[model samples]
Target: MTTPLTPHITTPITADLLRGALDLEQTAHGVLPHRLPARARAQCADGQLAMAESQPSGVRLVFRTRATAVELETLPTKRVYVGAPPRPDGVYDLLVDGRPAGSATVTGGSTLTVDMTTGTAEHRPGPPGTLRFTGLSAGVKDIEIWLPHNETTELVALRTDAPVGPVPDRGRKVWLHHGSSISQGSDAASPTTTWPALAASLAGVELINLGLGGGALLDPFTARALRDTPADLISLKIGINLVNTDLMRLRAFTPAVHGFLDTLREGHPTTPILVVSPILCPIHEDTPGPSAPDFSDLSDPGDPSDLSAGRLRFRAAGDPAERATGKLTLNVIRDELARLVEQRSADDPNLRHLDGRELYGEADFAELPLPDRLHPDAAAHRRIGERFAALAFTAGGAFAPEAA
Candidate 1:
């Protein structure tokens, strides 16, 4: 008499398990997580927003299972800049019972090659890849599979050695955060390791990260989205995106911020709203932008390897004199944000402002320079996340339990 074979369980991926994404679109192969809802996406035809939303920087697959082994099949759309340095493979982090258990990386996926000089991009199809993790602890355990923060992933399938079910909510406060690419996990090691993710874990809060890369231009729709989304705490990291993109002048900036806050207050009348200015970016600290790629020291174009080795840097192209004409820089934006929050807090006691410099100032910058002079690297992400948690989530802090 032979023993019966143990059966594996396959659960269909659904929205309930997802936390940070605003929308989920079912594809023929599987599902794609989007940070912006269909309505929001429809409002803006900007390619940057489209790309940023599709990346799902803070999105993860969460569940509870007794399984000892798990596997996820995905088709990630990896981006490649034609003349820029090669990016590392996207990492999928697995957490068991709130702790990191294992990690894996997909080997193959579609490639999106972009020419920054020409502003043109092309997509090339590639094969799907699988991530497998085994040797989990016994008994029921909470599990989270964090998607790559940089790559746009399409989930294909999930398999477990045992049945999986939704984890019961621990009644954690939901923190809704909005910001630019640094907050979008650029140069971050993994999804769960992103600054927002790290802060959320430390604060024991569920996160709804709206950290759109290059898309955090203080758009009315984004503020509207924040207003509609439910959250116990909210934070906005503004300034860098505006400066780097040279999106607006001080004349237009102040009113736009007020309008954005007004829209958010309409829905969250009493919620704690923290306004964080951009962290230290020396390149744009005083220099006005539209930041431009600096390929100045790069070797001659014939060799792709040399081209790849040539580190890409960004320079502020806007003149310092432009400030007299109402042009905005990081320093100017920070000052404005501080003053705005202070003025608003007189009547709106829930408003608070934290100097972004306190999080990553000159001292920290000297120790851990930004890799691209724009986005923070993995180690810096940790430093910023830890600092944010200590400053904003601890006692007497903006998001402290008593404050909330």
Candidate 2:
């Protein structure tokens, strides 16, 4: 227990307390978390990748402290699409001894405004904000402060009423997962509530989430980053991003997946690697995409007020016949992934494949629909998380400890 006489401690936020991020950069205000290291970032200059990596989806600060009160200062850069509905403020979740304790949101921070039609963006600076939690339990215990999953956060400083230190490692197996926006926690209520986070908690494995939003196009740099990171278990959720982004044809995607897996095997030859295909998205299951925002329901000369009213939605716009030309759809990609895994598993027994639809299948979709015709809502996140844990982490499952 910390006594009133104990002097307040101010600790510089460093890598020791951070989990899930691959790299950290010293910024003018504080430390900025990056999903990819500087070396990986240097190899590619895609704006989408830059934005997705900067948002700390699964990153959290973990430590043990007796402090009754704690304060965190941060500079969060929120993204605002021009003429689109304003996004809700990102929430910060706090946990004590692995249980939910409290949550908060900062009032003011920077904003990055984007004109999607013009493909231009602008930065607007705002003041740094503070988040404080008080009247916590007195005994020394583990504390986890999960950063906003959707916002680009720059951690400034941490202050506590008592001394703080990094929690000793519990020797849990590390699970490295990479995927698209859904895995990046697009509609999850908070960072810890994301499916991967939930599954990690249930499975009792440390997590390193590389689920970049629009950036999961199987870029070589990301493959290199995955190849170098240490992990006992690895999973890649592929397909949807490639299909929606219209980034590649079937020919290119098949080779890309092989190359990506080849790179990862270079570092972990026998580590358990699970390749998952895309979940059932009604709009994109048969129709090809580059999906675009849908505004037809709004009045003609569409009301900007309606835009800000949170009625934004997306629709798959590509023709279904394009599949004949090698353009991929969700169904086509899933079949290809299954075939690829079946072919490769003959020799690489450590490699396995899971159908994503099993995680969120037709029945599940009918019950809990995707709000934006893309990302799953909160309830769906829970369903998917629970299903994933039971399917992959249970006894004799591909990700089971003994399987490794």
Candidate 3:
């Protein structure tokens, strides 16, 4: 038997040791492993940064960086959200080098937000102010805070708590993942429990969380984001929200998905990409989503009841033959992804796909009944995280030890 390679571990960091000037570019920023809250009192105790969380009831955190400028990027890795339902008004924040530079706010009532913040910045929130750091220096002496709950927060990470030393390069490997709310981390106990963060930790790779709440429409913009990002390994979790949101027509969805995948190929070239469909949702499994007009809001013409059925937003596998053939249900998406990868595999050895149900399905659902009967809870998040590690990062998986 061969020996397992031991990773170079660093000394534990301390706040007292972090005091001084630092550089963000030259030194490495320790990664945050889980989702954390945003309240000062709560954050002071937990000290974990919010790596990712469900959208809408969005999460935020503060980072005290010594680097003169900071950059924030989103990974396509996903999480699902299930709660009292997050407010459409939710937004994500970014503090540069130390000061609040820019923020991503919910716009046009759109449920998706993805943008990278860079350059010098300052505090910009108007009320109920969050912690603000003054001028920051450079060389990795900084703290990153994570805020999961509107009422609670946590301190997540630091670059220079330990003694200053030559920072080793944390090789660049993009981790791309996509999925519904569970991937969006709907009701996870804390932000960190989300599967994407957990998987990234075990793999030791950069993350790009693209899980959108009720908005993974497979839209071109989303495809654009995926296509543009630099990824070493990619995974997509489809289904769930499409069914839950009852957003589209089957006819329109088929091509949209094909196009989305096509776009991603344009950018990644040869990087490994995984496409994942949704977990099992009993409410919409065999039933068709409600598509009649939502009387409450004429602008929102789609059937509100459809959202409750738990089906993909745009398409459904209504034909028995198609279901048998695996056409348009969550399973259909999974199968189609497999087919896509198979067709492309001959030319692109990097393409791969997996079924979301493999991660969590009927039996798992029985163990963890989602509060909303739609999204998974914190326990489920842990289960999903473990499952992902087994498949995506293990020695037997597609990626090599380092790439994972």
- Highest lDDT: which candidate? 2
The runs of at least 3 residues in candidate 3 whose Cα sits more than 4 Å from the true structure, single-residue gaps closed, are 1-126, 131-142, 147-169, 290-328, 402-404
Clashes of each: 0, 0, 62
- lDDT score of residue 368 within candidate 2: 94
lDDT of 3 by residue, 1-404 (tens): 83432222233333222211011111133322222112311333211112222231223333333343322222112212321133333234443433344443222211222111121222222222222322344456433322332222122232222233333334657676655556666666544456776676566665556565555657565566567656678777766655544555466666776777778889877777666666776655664443222223323435442323322122233443444433345555555566766786788666666677777888898888654556677788788888887887776666666444
Q: Quantify how close model 2 is to the true structure by its C-alpha RMSD in Å.
A: 2.3
Worst 10 residues of 2 by lDDT: 300-309
Candidate 1 lDDT tens digits, 9-64: 77898988777888889987799999988888999998778889899888999999
Assess candidate 2 and give its TM-score to the true structure.
Answer: 0.96
Best-to-worst lDDT order = 2, 1, 3
Better of 1 and 3 by lDDT: 1
Residue-wise lDDT of candidate 2 within 1-404, one digit each (tens)? 94443336889888999999999999999999999999999988888889899999989999999998899999999889887767888899999999999999987899999886688889999999999988888899999999999999999889898888999989999999999999999999999989999999999999999999988899999999999999999999998989888989999989999999999999999999999999899999999989887765567445432455665678898999999999999999999999999998998999999999999989988899887789999889988999899989988778987898
Work out candidate 3's RMSD over C-alphas: 14.1
lDDT of each: 0.89, 0.90, 0.48
Per-candidate TM-score against the hidden true structure: 0.95, 0.96, 0.57
